[model samples]
Target: MTIKHKITLYSSLFFSGFYALIALFIVMSFASFRAEEFKERLNEKALTTIRLLLDVKELDNDLLKIIDQNSIHQLYDEKTLIFDENFNLIYSSLDDTKIHWTTGDLEILKTEGAYFKSEGENEIYGIKHLNNGKQFYAIVSANDNYGKSKLRYLTTIVIITFLVFLLATWLFTFTLIKKQLKPLDEFHENISQINDLHIERQLATKENSKNEIDLLSIEFNQMMSRITEVYNLQKDFTAHVSHELRTPLLKLSAQVENQLLQQKGENDLFLKSMMQDIAQLNELINSLLLLTKNNQTNPREYESIRIDEVLYAAFEKISHDFKDISIDFSIAESVAETPEILEVKASPNLLEIAFSNLIKNAYLYSDNKKVQVKIYKDNHKLKLSIINAGSKIADKAEDILFKPFKRGENTADSKGLGIGLTIVKRILTNFDFSIEYTFGSYTHQFLIIF
Candidate 1:
């Protein structure tokens, strides 16, 4: 997962656990308060029942039951019992529900002077009452239905509120984290676009912002500045060396050619071989010069050049070099009628160099000195494939096919430096194109997707 998502998830979980504890505390505290409050109400009922039975001369158990049955403040399933000093039953409430009590319970109530407890779903409150020198025990039992209903309602509200707040916390955390990391996202996008050709480019930074991401951008810019300076120095050195050697090499080649024309002996063959060696050395210098020039060239200077014309130009040059080589070129029928379909925006010279290298490599390595070049539309994009029948490349050699100074295992007999595919790949990649190699049926294929 991305940093944004992970931060949001962890933050939300922490807040959820914290809020859940708070909700539990609130519900439990309220429940405890309700239980104590209901017990007080039961105790008040028991004392009032004992007072009416003892102090009022006209009051009787039968009349008190009528009063309790009609009282507006009556509790649900309320029951009351009274006992004389001798532990004889004196009064009972109208309800048939029995208030279970053992002698030990009554004795404890007498000793303590008052008591409160729970019997199943009912609360029981007891008190020792003394009136006119006579002692009496009063007990009351009832279910606090109203208080319990209030507790259930409060519990439901707490649960609902907890859920709503949890959702809000998650959403707020997600938004805040995404907003805080926006600069990092932009940094990744900008850094991905930097390459050796654009090594001087620097990431943009916000003024007066001192966050870690902004600090990273500043450090990266400083690092790239040092790298660009070193890269430019090296590039200038290589170009200067290559340029200084070219004049002497050209003059030596001219001298050798003149000598070969005049001499007619075994020395002529040796001089001719020397000329060939000079030519190969010249080609290597030229390839290096091309690479340096490509890096220096601005991409904006490229123009719309026809792809077919570039191929034909490259083919003409390859055929002159390899007298026995031939190429079969074809365009798919879907785009053959439209000449504009073959046009691409690129540097004509650089693209020609890339295609020429590929075509030359194809002809040089083919068994029959023949290559097939085809152009077609794939997924609405232009694609070109150059195929040659030859020994298949080994699996281990496939990965290094486009690396400089690297060649396939089957290319030991080929007469060229190993930097051709590397140059081709660099040029194509600069133009936002891609190339891949595939082998099947003893044919080596290089596919270029534009």
Candidate 2:
């Protein structure tokens, strides 16, 4: 069932059961109390009748005569039964055949001052020993008309009250549930209004809501924010990758096309230039793939790495591959006093690829024949800078240089796939590291912070 309906049903059931128990208790207690009150009034009347008629000290028929003559004896609904000491009926209102009067019934006057009770139908009878216990046994019966009516009335009222209470409880509980869930419903509505265009707007998590639903809404919005950030990064990365890869591919394809379509036999120098362009294209493709692979890995697998060692190893690999560039490095040692040597924890292969691309860019872009690689420690952060006497990027180009396939004014002299720095920045970001480019009158510098 839906949460709203489940809440309503549970609320209804809880109130119904509670009201039912309360109704049963009230009806039973009220009925019992009213019955006791009626019985007390009946007893009082019976005692009064016994007191007025009976002369307890005398064994005579004088009181019986007075009782028979009293005009005030109009309150009681009674039948007279007179019995002897031997427990045999002498004078009776009920015929012996009608009641089948046994010794037990005729022995109502057990002593000189005995009062006893018996039930017939819905009325109760109080038999009082009277007339000196010789010839008269006073029988007074009272019907509990008020008591019965009170019970019936109370029973009806109890049922009606229970029904009303049940309805009220259900409505109140369901209304309360709806009130509690209102914020959650609003939270969902706010989230639904959000899409790629509206990613910047966050949900309102009110402080007054000291509850789980509020926390859930806040966390959900945070997740959405992160997703939007990654999505934007991916879009920028894609655009940069396309722009970077296209130039090299076109150059390589043109070279192949020229070789294929030529009528004359291709010279060795022309074929060599074509092969060099093909190699540059292949290198650009490899770097882009490495960037994509790093982003695709399960993030949980990344770990802390020593920046100096990882960079030194990457530099060695690049130096082996490109023998033309004279690469030099100075690395600091890691220590308890110098934990800054370990900049971040990340996938080893990915960091290597990123650093490798940065060093290779300095080599490819440098007009002078040498590249300088330097490493240093600053607190817990590592700073690795690669400097080359190469093309000084334009002031305008600095803005879009990190964007994929973005080339600068100095681009004409070199074969570049424009996305190397973009990939490097992306890979470093995955490891929580950052990159900054410093361009000067004669220096093109890239700094990686660990």
Candidate 3:
């Protein structure tokens, strides 16, 4: 899951737990208050019943019973009974649901003035009443059915409200989090678009914001500025040094060759070796100059060209330079008659340079001085490959093979500057192409997919 989803899930859980506790507390508090309120109402009914029983002298048993049953206010399922000090019944408000009382219960009511007891769902309240020093007890009991029904309804409302609120909170939190992290999403997109070709471009920041994302953008821009400064300086130095050194190196090689031609003595071998060294140095200088151009060249210089024609030109050049090497070249029969398959948009000079490097590497490292070149179309993509019979590249070279100054085990027996493949890869990347290296049991292959 993404960070936004994780944050939303955790925040929903946290808020749900918090709201659940609040709902529970509300329910418990309301239940307690309702129970206490019912108890108070029962006690008040008992007091009122006793007051009428004691103060009304003309009130007979039937009249008192009638008044208790019909006129006395009571809660749902209410019942009442009155008893004298002698434990004889005076009046009963209920016909079937009786409030059973023992002498000890009456004693408690007489001593304490009021007594309360609960039997199952029924709540009973008893009070002692006195008239002319005569003692009587009045008792009331009920289940508070109306209050219980109200509480059930309230409980359902609380539960539904809690669920609705939880859902609303989760949606609101998810939306708010997505809005808040929008900057990070944009930052990631911008970072993905950055490459060495656009190294000088800076990350954008809000003008008046000092948030962490804004600060991060500021730091990234500063870092890119430093990298661009260093990269430009390196490119300039390489180009200038190569241009300056190539002339002297070529002059030195020419003078040494002339000396060897004229003398032809014991020092002839030494002069030839010195001339070879100068030639290798000159090659390195030229490769460095190409590298600088690859780094600084603009993509607008590219135009439509036949990739097959460029490959043939590079192959011919390598063939003329190294006649001892033999190369087998072929075009796939499927595309033999298809001229459009050979066309691609790229810089022909850069393409030829890259192909030349690959051809040279194949020639220098092949054990039998033989290479195979193939061009084909696979799955609507143009595929080109150069295979050479050579020692397999070392496993460690897979990661750093395209890096500058990185060579493989096969290059140990070859004369090279270790930047041939690196330059080839850099040149291809500018044209939206890439190179792949594959090792077979007896052949090394460089595959280019366009």
Provide backbone clash counts, one per model: 0, 4, 0
User: TM-scores of the models, in the given order?
Assistant: 0.78, 0.43, 0.65
Model 3 residue pairs with clashes:
none
Can you write out model 1's per-residue Cα lDDT over 357-391, one digit (the tens) per residue? 99988888899989999999989899999999998
Score candidate 1 by TM-score against the native. 0.78
Instruction: Estimate the TM-score for candidate 2.
Output: 0.43
* Candidate 1 lDDT trough over 10 residues, lowest sum: 292-301
Report the lDDT tens digits of candidate 2 across residue range 1-450. Answer: 869879889878877887788888888898678656755665565555444434354624455535533646432344444554555544433312232234554455454344434456334443545455454443435456656777888899888888888788778877898898898788878977664335556888877666888888778878988887897688678657856887868777777767766735647567767768777766666655554442544345666677767877887898798877788777666533566545466887778888888888888878876888887767756688888985566679889978888888877777788888888777777666789899787888888876
Kindly report the root-mean-square deviation of model 3 from the true structure over all alpha carbons.
6.2
Off by over 4 Å in 2: 1-16, 41-86, 90-142, 192-201, 205-223, 247-450
Per-candidate RMSD, Å: 4.3, 20.4, 6.2
Q: Please state the error at residue 1 of candidate 2 in Å.
A: 4.2
lDDT of 3 by residue, 332-396 (tens): 98878887888887888889999999988888988889989999989888899999987666789
Best by TM-score: 1
Highest lDDT model number: 1
Residue pairs whose backbone atoms clash in candidate 2: 240-404, 244-405, 303-345, 304-345
Ranked by TM-score from best down, the candidates are 1, 3, 2
lDDT for model 2 comes to: 0.68
